[model samples]
Target chain A: MAMQERALRTRKSLIHAAAAVFAEEGYVPSSLGTISKRAGVSNGALHFHFENKRALAQAVEDEAADAVRGLVRRADRTGASALQALVDTTCGLVDSLLDDIVVRAGFQLSAERALGPEARLLRTWHEWVEQALLGAEAEGQLAPGVSPDDTAAAIVAVTVGLEVLAGVDPQWLAERRIAGFWELLLPGIATEQVLASALPEAHEGRRSEAEEA
Target chain B: MAMQERALRTRKSLIHAAAAVFAEEGYVPSSLGTISKRAGVSNGALHFHFENKRALAQAVEDEAADAVRGLVRRADRTGASALQALVDTTCGLVDSLLDDIVVRAGFQLSAERALGPEARLLRTWHEWVEQALLGAEAEGQLAPGVSPDDTAAAIVAVTVGLEVLAGVDPQWLAERRIAGFWELLLPGIATEQVLASALPEAHEGRRSEAEEA
Candidate 1:
């Protein structure tokens, strides 16, 4: 058991190191030597853990996929409205894309190649989101004409898009900017009444909480 | 004047060739030798026009920026209502992003680094769109309570995001998918009346056009 734990920890350390290097220098330029050096592991140890750089990259992507799925699952468990859950979960993702290097690398790397595990993870997230949108529509949380499939895809696109832009322009990742993003997005998916009531309530709550703290 | 014209054509050829190479091989991996070879020019001739690879990249980015600006300017000159112009202009950008390799390269390169000229170009585009949004709002063409700056930024973010995703997933870039994107986006910016009339017309037009042609 102890040996397994040690292996897991070593594997995680390598992934973290690899994600950072990949995000900084990109896939091709980021070398295995640099990743190993950053992980504070010998080259032989790095090789023992992963077969190649592509494997290490896949591991990083897999870890990211799991983290994202875990977040959605936690949101699901909360029994919140589907729209609310999606907004909260998406906001969490945006925060990570702005602040978390590993998550950013996972997204960037996944796009550059056809990594199967990573692709499956992303597709699963999309499916989960599609299910959530269907629920939101059935609940009448969505607007009259909004298609569940399109809205789900748009929400995913907008969330991913905002993150991509944020990754490039840090200033645009501010809390206010994220709030603006939600404002633009939620209206499309939400009924007019929900937009008039729930969105303002959520925004105001965050503002007041920030002030009180 | 004749010599200047010859130089202009050579410079244009170099920019086109360089953009293709950069898109395929990326920045560091794409060498000056490859660019010159593609352009059918000698290394000395390539250097005569561009001081280095960075300079060549800047030239390519400049060409792309100009293309984007030109597209927007053409949209603005359409003599449509401010809101109509905004929507049409955005749609034009979406088309260019889908079809134009130079624009794609510019966007990719800009996100990867904080190049000065590239930053300026993007900022200029952003400001232009913001100004247009402000005008639309003042003219009562925009939906009530929509902040021009936020909406403008969201538009930029969404468009850039869609383009990036399309790069990764061509399957998602299908006409039907893009139409879905417009459906989600147009409602937020359009007035209720405009949404009722304009969106359906535009959507059907694009759909039939995509289908028949």
Candidate 2:
């Protein structure tokens, strides 16, 4: 392999190792040495890719942010209803949270004490939720009497709540559970017309671009 | 003060100190020595009521459980709508989690890695939600098609998630935020009759037993 290719591979390995360690041990207890050992890379190589653990954690957060952006973009492009897009985005989100170690570590590290101001991932996620729901409201997709702001609060709370619950029980991360939230919430928020034609079931996580396209 | 009164006072002080330390520093890192120092009690006094750190944590948990039971008991006896009782109980719960150090520590400790299966406090809280919502369903206070089980799940997630958010920003625990949650949800869950008369606002936290009575 080319020298650049090998270097990139080594960097990926270190991040994977760092994410697993952070997810399990949190920020204070985890060590660079353990992350290096897990990555099967030399300590020097780990240091070469990242200056310190905080930097490594930041990289994880950036990656998670990118992953979320991808999910939202997919939802935006779909000719699906604005409400279904929101639902699909959450489905994709829970899938990433369940399947993506970097995303998990991004969140876990963001909450750690050692990296005190790094919780921007949640803030960013919240911003996306607000914007998307507002857009949906303007398009007249919302039910009568439901304010976009209040609906935003409910959606953000439940999503964050599910994330916290997932920490204790993986069962909380199931797609059906996410579906249950929308199933309960949509009736109160969406118009009858939207419900009849555009309401999606609480199944299917984020669909890939090619398939949906 | 009488000797017995003074002794009881000292015990109360010690538990308060332990809860503050545990809430800030968590289970493993907080020292009994610091708790004693904070309590302004001698080491002997600290040892008299609680044998060790774990014991001290257990005491906090027990006290928190008692406090929750008190809230629910008052709600249950008021001859109010079962749905209102659930709302008020959560209002009271958020108030305690915000203002009561022991309650906050009890929840924090329940989620600690060192405690193993000692997360009974959360399970107990979940049970109460399930039963209360179920009772409301039986009384026909619930709107048509709103399942008690799914509603219970949303309530637990939002409560736990808000508690976690409160750790970072006290704003999350504001009475309005909690009220906002219920206001958004009550419409979907409560019957029209209940909505006309019993719809909860984002106005009050847990009311005192005297006030509610």
DockQ of each: 0.36, 0.30
Superposed Cα deviation of residue A163, candidate 2 (Å) = 1.9
| Tens digits of per-residue lDDT for model 2, B122-155 | 7788889999999999998987666687888888
Summarize candidate 1's per-residue lDDT along A104-192 as a digit string, tens digits.
78887766653642365456667888988888888889876677887776666666666656655776666666677666666555776
The runs of at least 3 residues in candidate 1 whose Cα sits more than 4 Å from the true structure, single-residue gaps closed, are: A1-3, A114-122, A192-213, B1-6, B114-118, B171-179, B193-213
Backbone atom clashes (below 3 Å) for every candidate: 0, 1
Comparing only chain B with the true structure, the TM-scores of all models are 0.84, 0.89
Q: Provide candidate 1's TM-score on chain A.
A: 0.85
**Model 2 misses residue B187 by how many Å?**
2.6
How does the DockQ of candidate 1 come out?
0.36
Candidate 1: give the clashing pairs: none
